[model samples]
Target chain A: MVERTEKRHTEKMKKKQAAHDKIMAGKTAEKGLLIVHTGKGKGKTTAALGMVVRAIGHGKKVGVVQFVKGAMATGEKAVFDAFPGNIEFKPMGEGFTWDTQDRARDIAVARGAWDEVKRMIEDPSYDMVLADELNIVLRYDYLPLEEVLPVLTGRAPMKHVIVTGRNAPEALVAEADLVTEMTLVKHPFREQGVKAQPGIEY
Target chain B: MVERTEKRHTEKMKKKQAAHDKIMAGKTAEKGLLIVHTGKGKGKTTAALGMVVRAIGHGKKVGVVQFVKGAMATGEKAVFDAFPGNIEFKPMGEGFTWDTQDRARDIAVARGAWDEVKRMIEDPSYDMVLADELNIVLRYDYLPLEEVLPVLTGRAPMKHVIVTGRNAPEALVAEADLVTEMTLVKHPFREQGVKAQPGIEY
Candidate 1:
């Protein structure tokens, strides 16, 4: 019985490998990607930061601009600070929209953050740029989508850009090369009364 | 007109802040979390690695075991190796299930990996334990869910554990404190003929 099962598994794997190889053979293009992480769940920024870490590991330069989470200190900020040569970490926002309470001020902050993002994209020295929470700013119309879309679309071919937030615009999703929406299944903050702790939330 | 807008914004923000403070005040519980990142999209393992970086930044010890992605050298392995004191990174898998093509071997490898995970969970010096892609093994019945769920649920109260993969068992999800499902919205590999690159996909 075991020998029969082994034979069946080997035959199935042989067929699967052939299929996988054929698909992979056609995937020959290598270039920078526009990755979007969206949805009402968490890990949008966390995943983007993971990419930043990967870029750093590969000895590539990275630029990070936090659009709506710069009001207070965060664990990522402290971690990114350690790699001064590899990353230019900028948390330019005053706070979340509701926390800031001023539309005009929010727009101004977004504009400033967007400028930093543009600088990183246009500069060839940086290999990856993370526009953290840019979607939230776009959702609130703090930064004009018209202005944002063109710059992102026209970025250097070899440069990677990651935009992350909840409620990403339809146009951005359509243009992205890879997009993942994080869906919240169960949250302890709501169901178990657990507070956000360091090294996990931040 | 601008002054009126500013005044209204201030009033709205005041009410929002009061509500936020009240909600935050009630959240006083502090303990370890069983975080599960599962779905068909990308970033499940990436986000878990991000938390590993965060833990390293905070001077906390971390244990990471990659169940099914150790056949080749990955960029993350090279990076995590730099932090010898903070992280114990282990990639125990021979490869993906189809690539291995032997159910008995897969089960044996999974058992070995699970032993490492359990060791980390039982070790008090480790602040966080990441069972990277553990759900895939559970999904395939390579590791018994009955044996897995209890150890995860009965872990030390102060030790955070993160399990990530697609198709998480419902029991694990139910026991988890935080669960995020990564849904594939658009993939470049399917749509744009792009292959996964080192810094982004690894």
Candidate 2:
């Protein structure tokens, strides 16, 4: 009788313990990582913005630095307006590089923007960072990939960083923890002959 | 002098004309929107994986669903482990409500698993929706937000939805118009004797 009782008791304990193991395990993790959203597709900036909202929803602090495509009043501005003090929205305006006749001025703006954004990446306080449209900078060679990578990866406070734009360099892809390539199957501009719109395009 | 002036005016007028309007003018948009991530995160079978990723990205397509997270074997599995797949990861068992509990059964297995996840957030083919915390399902709810959202949204076309969780949500977030969230902040677990090692509490 004792032997039988002992066996039953052990089985019950095993069952109980299995139940306990599931939730208690895997609850801890490091603080930060990187996600790169790039490709020949649209929505790179939009994806970064989406992440910004998701981070904020979970009660995280986030910053957005637009490396290109900064004309003004994009919808993301509405989010910035709604949140007010919580979010820092910085738009690095170059509008369209091809249209900028002044090469010196264009280079100046690119340089100025990178210096500002690089400073932000190095700061450990930000919970999440969005380097919007920064891909173009790398693609256009406005910034050196090697110089930017270590700073972005190292000092991020274990916080999250998102870099978005088209034509991300192969080197950048290799370094990213998570990388997404947006492929454009079709776009409306091809049919309408309409120029880019405000709020939407900018 | 008058004839010369007229000719000069005509020449200038006929020289060239170009117009540019951004998309924000409400000209074009992604036809259908939804998110699917077979990547990683804490919970699965807890929410529909598509709704959140999309709405947060673009403002199109809506009404989709998933309970539980993507399939396991990723970073998310480390975080969520064997959390519930029922009632969208009910914290009642091991919900991480306060963050201090052995919480194996309460955290891992749920009552119905896919049976339960299949019930909530039905059909993301409609319009914008939110599949909050669906990853818990994977622990028990095991519904694979990836397999579900992709086929559904791909078939629906021209709608938007979002899916939220860690570990990729990749396949979905990749095809998603937008994807992002959860960089992690001052979590309370660190104060406790918690460490996010793999399998057990990643």
Candidate 3:
């Protein structure tokens, strides 16, 4: 029994060490500015969600904009809406950039949504703002990097924003307060050829 | 658009004010116990979970004895099994408390399982201990509170425990570091006159 206790405790200590390392990965993230999540990894949004739930538990108000995220239905969206009118979530209806079919309409939606998201960045009302899948928008040039940069830098005096997508731009990452390139460690999908699990993935 | 900005900022300030008030509620809970959970909250388990998660985020190793929880194949139990693994979840299957209806059999499971939970408290390995739904056992008199009190108070040097169930005793409340009474506030089954939703309610 004592040996069982010691083994798991050692594992626990190793995890604590990893968490500490992740914390120290970026110095500017301490003051909170921007988070850039990019790479061929599956969980940029999941990592952002871990942070969102942590902030909410700490009594923070959050605003979220999901570019190319509107399919009009998802279990997560349902759960997000169930949070008694405190948390705010808005999804740009263009859904996936590739799936939208009309490039011009997608760009128009992204541009229009950018105006609202840009304002939220500078407004002190949101404790955290998650611009989900915006990296893809930037990658495809649906929104200019010039327009994105100012909001990233001059965010609401209190608001912190996280940008998640694969293939995020180099300049954006260079400017980000915290940049985490999620490396593909080991994913169940790859091993088993299983599709994304709804609750776990989306 | 300008009005929207002002409104968002105003809401932010109000949320900050509400946050200040909620901060005190956590302090009220700090008589030295924490509970952390990372599973679906279909039943009474979610309330038990929020405390466990809050406790561990503050750096607590928690021990849990899940009497009726181990026998079933639930998504929550799988996730709990995957948690940092420092969380000791011994799922001794006795089925629902009333179903077994045998005092001798019930007492043996309680004795065997609570023995490990008690060991966690005495050895200083646990910061918070949750005997999830042990209150039901207490109500049935399968385990004597006298057998529990010494382990609870003597372990006061390093641990805090949460016992959750439907009909908690008045004496247990007095002994608890924090007691939360989850009154079934407008349950879905009663409201919709439908069966409990799978994974949302047991």
Candidate 4:
């Protein structure tokens, strides 16, 4: 029985190896990417920041422009702050939509954040730019899709951009090279009846 | 009109504050959680490590047990290695199942890794324990859920445990306080014909 299992496993391995090698052989082109993290679940921003951290680890310059979550201090911001030279972070949003009901102000702030994004993407030094929560701003129509889409497509060829938030637009989704939607399976707010906590939520 | 907009904004802020305060009033209980990152998309492991980086930023001890990815060096494992005292990491797996074509050896390694998990959870020194890719082992039945669930349920109240992998069982999902399913919308492998890249996929 052991011999049979070993033989079967070896056959399976040979098949998988061939497929992996063939697929990888066709994958030679390398360039920058526009990655999107969106959906009705947690870890959208967290995953983007994870990429940022990875980029920083690889000695790549990273710039983060937080579009709609600047009201309170977060642990991520604090951690990024520690890596001063490696990270350039700007948390420019006023707060959530309900917290700031002024449409004009939200638009102005989002534009300011976008300007920063433009600067970061254009700068040759920055390899990765994270537009944190830019999806929410776009969803609320604070920034016109025509304007934002053009800027994204015009980014540097070697610069990776990560846009994160819920309800990402279909146009942006179509434009992105990689996209991951975080699905809500279970949440403390809905399941355990708990609010967001530090280190976990922030 | 400007004055009217300002007044409307003030009223909105007042209503939002009241709602925020009301929701926060019931959120006095603070403790750790069992967070599961699973699904068909990417970022399951990245999100879990993002939490680990956040915990390290907050000066907490972290223990990471990598179940099935120990062959090649990853950017995350490299970054975590920089912080010696803060992170205790064990990349216990030989590799993925296909890479290691020995089922008996895979089960043995998984069991050895689970022993490390048992030690970490009971040590009381680790504030957060990340069982990275534990789901894959459980999915293959290398380790039974009956044995694993009890150890998880019996963990310290203040300790946070994050389990990440694909095909997480329904029982573990039920036991978790937070679960995020990363859904694949667009992948480089599928769309752009690219295999995993350094500092991004790793």
Better of 3 and 4 by DockQ: 4
**Per-residue alpha-carbon lDDT of candidate 3 for residues A1-202, written as tens digits (9 for 90 to 100):** 8567556655654666566555444323124456666666444665565455445544466777878777523534543443434467777756564444455676798887677678677777677888888888888787999988887887754466888888988888777655555444343343333343223234
Candidate 3 per-residue lDDT over residues B1-202, each given as its tens digit: 8567556645664665576545534432113432211111122354354444444444456776776665633523433343464466667746764444444566788777778778777767677777777776676666898887667666664366656666666666555433333222122232233332222222
Cα displacement (angstroms), candidate 3, residue A47, comes to 1.2
Q: What is the TM-score of each candidate against the true structure?
A: 0.96, 0.51, 0.46, 0.93
Clash pairs, model 1 backbone: none
Model 3 residue runs over 4 Å out of place are: A1-30, A188-191, B1-202
lDDT of 2 by residue, B96-153 (tens): 3122222243233333333333333345533444453444443332355655564436
lDDT of 3 at A193: 38
Those runs of model 1 whose alpha carbons end farther than 4 Å from true positions after fitting are A71-74, B1-8, B71-74
- Tens-place lDDT per residue, model 4, A58-155, is 76789989998784346675566656788888888877767776778888999999999989988999888999999988987778999889888898
Model 1's TM-score against the true structure: 0.96
RMSD of each: 1.7, 12.0, 21.0, 2.3
Query: Could you give candidate 2's per-residue lDDT for residues A133-184 as a string of tens digits?
Result: 7777777666788888887767554667778777777777776656655555
Error of 1 at B109 (Å): 0.9
Enumerate residue pairs that collide in model 4.
none
As a whole number from 0 to 100, the lDDT of residue A1 in candidate 2 is 82
Q: Could you tell me which 10 consecutive residues in candidate 2 chain A have the lowest summed lDDT?
A: A193-202
- State how far residue B94 of model 4 sits from its true place (Å): 1.5
DockQ of each candidate, alpha-carbon based: 0.69, 0.09, 0.02, 0.56
What are the Cα lDDT values of the candidates?
0.89, 0.49, 0.58, 0.85
Model 2: what is its DockQ?
A: 0.09
